[model samples]
Target: VESISVKKIETVEEFKDLKIQKSEKGRGISLTLPPDIAICEECLKDLRYKNKKKYYMYPFVACAVCGPRYTTVNALPYDRERSTMIEFPLCNEDKTSCVKEYKDFNNRRFHAQTFACAVCGPQYQLYDRSKNIIETNSIKEILEITARRINSGEIAAVKGMGGVHLICLAEDDKVLEELRNRKKERKYKPFAIMTPKLAILENLVIFSEKERELLTSFRRPIVILGKKKGSNDGILSNQVAPGLSSIGVMLPYAGIHYLLFDFIGQKSLIYTSGNVSNLPMGIRNEMIFEQLKGLADFFLLHNRTIFQRCDDSVLRVHNDKVKLIRRSRGYVPEYLPLPFEVEISGALATGPELNVTGAVLRRNRVFPTQHIGHIKSLETFNFLKNALFNIKNLLQIEDKEIEFIACDLHPSFYTTTYAKELAEKYGINYFPIQHHFAHVLGLM
Candidate 1:
């Protein structure tokens, strides 16, 4: 591979002077990040070997193919310094003294990015609904307590990959009722349950071979699987599926989630966004208290501040094909190369209504933000606005330098409205692309 180095530019003037060129004599491969993968076979073997120094019990063991992505990232270039991993500095002492060849090898995370261990990585904490500290520095003890409380029919707000999820034993009627009453979510919108693995899900859902494969895929989206005939009614109350024929299900996406499901003693558990219905998922403890005060009996939280809010992505298998209903988390931040590289520098794309996804265009690609959910509430709108700013800042683009702003033609859309306002405020040209046509153009 050919290499070139340029002085780092920290100012807009200096940034303008920098040039990125493609070699005239070569063809190269461009790889978008594999959407947050499940533990690969190599890493799984390393984890399963009991005698190995990095054994299966190591909760933080991961390879380049798997682990946290958009959730832990605070900015772009996707380096550790630009991510939440910056909170935990590298253990120089351990690095110098370690004898493991892999530890020092030029692998994916060998000075690649976002490397951490249980020793220096993020930690867990617990709190009551009243914001009183319950415990700290003990994830196992806290999870055990939370599981006990849940079994006793109490709701617990558990923080996970992207945002908080209110976890409850799926089979408990009283707990479901209490959760519904507390959150005032009386609608029949089915809750997504996290199964420990695909084997556990087969008992609850009658999945075709194709459906099973999609469910077990690396993306691990909340797949709307066909519920088994005469499945346990108490597992998910009728309220969970007032009119829908299927329920959403997903596998554990993080190591903590895997442990949580194991501790809960069930092969599966109810996992839904920890927020009032129609609002954004809770990202911080303070926000959780403000939004889910009476909704949760206790909080199993962590010290790591979520830099972004990504809801669980939803998908459905139809006619032997997987269709994405909501795209977030495991499938974001990676840029999509445009057919033609436009001159519009740092353009913001206010996505269409319903399953909204914002985008930031730079160079020859567009980076779509995680699913922002239906933009009907103030909370969702504020999230869109903040996400736009965050995307621009992370990409190191100034508002004044944004050459264009893109929005959907739907005038009724709040996102479109916001895009218009931003265009006016920034004195940039606004391009209103028809929603349907844009999708067609994208496919072409």
Candidate 2:
């Protein structure tokens, strides 16, 4: 199939029957599921493209090739009906012109399932801490007001593709201190900042060419880079990274983020996950309000549901190579091939107790989950279980098909105990591997 090529046809009607067939079980691998992609350059231009009136300033504007994937998908086959975008149906123009664009092979959005626009897509609205909505004239105005509030020292819970982010002015020490006080667990921990563009980042951070690539990459992970000599000359507050010499900085990845910067005067904004302590970041609207009740002074929420909670991935360039600090959002659900083929058809690895990301091995490929944070509390532990369940369902991996369940050697760890429980429930073999040994095996 890889070597096969299609012969040229004189007319479009000649290839009417040509189609992509679905992969059957044991025949081939399932369709590769991509992680949530950052907004593309064309879509960014469409935000202000006067001629593309439908998508003008649309925060949820997306096409077939880009936007939410793993985070929005609710089932296999990866169709719009099987994604969170199902509720937000296409508008008249989207159904006609946009649909035609997808049919056009030359168009970038050819056969794109996530096609959307302002008239018929998920919309954002600003709300107060008391759950009351703040009326606005337009979507652009809403973001402008939100930015003004954030700049005026108000914390905002901004809903992203996967989860909500607690946003505040990056250069306000008093605001940063208040955010720390509210998010008790983040007292000493550093917060990541989001810059509006790349030119501003060049003057603030000392990063290599490779580091710059990571910062502006489509995955858009938060890259840790050293600060310039006078980087903190009123641009960034000392409290951003505390004692650390490096700071986590990322460029605006979404349309909302870009629109927010359009109204604000700050060079960067503190963009940290909106969650308490060891719990997972909030995804549902009600859950977010409850989770970040007092922490966020205002809420910049959206109607689109985040099927899965994926935190921003963190990475750093060391010795001209990239090292993943926290892998999520842009990097999960993709398979990693093992060096040697194993006879086992399927296997499960319940990850460690902290910064956990479970893995499922199917045939020769190992599929790791999005970052699941610390699995210490019941909430986080359940989140891990659900994450594993979701990936398993997507891959159509049955419990009986799993050859073994692997866990940390430490018996007291929740993952270890869960592995044992799953083994018993599924009547499968279970094994324990030292945490460091598992890491070494992965690297090899």
Using lDDT as the measure, the top candidate is: 2
Model 1 lDDT per residue over 93-163, tens place: 55432222225444534433444555555667788878999854455677678778877878888886678
Off by over 4 Å in 1: 1-35, 39-63, 92-103, 106-109, 233-239, 335-346, 352-354, 362-366, 392-401, 410-413, 433-444
Best by TM-score: 2
Q: lDDT tens string, model 2, 1-444?
A: 125777986765644443435434342344356888899988888887878888888887777657989999887777778888889766545444666665676677766777677777888988899889999999878977987788889899999889999999999999999999998878889999999888899888898888888888889999999988888889899989988889999988888888888888646999999999888988999999999998999999999989989999998987898888888988887777778877776788898898899988888888888899889899999999999888888888877888999999998999999999999998988999998998788777
Worst 10 residues of 1 by lDDT: 23-32
Q: Considering only N, C-alpha and C atoms within 3 Å, which residue pairs clash in candidate 2?
A: 64-112
Q: Report every candidate's CA lDDT.
A: 0.71, 0.85
Clashing pairs in 1: 47-56
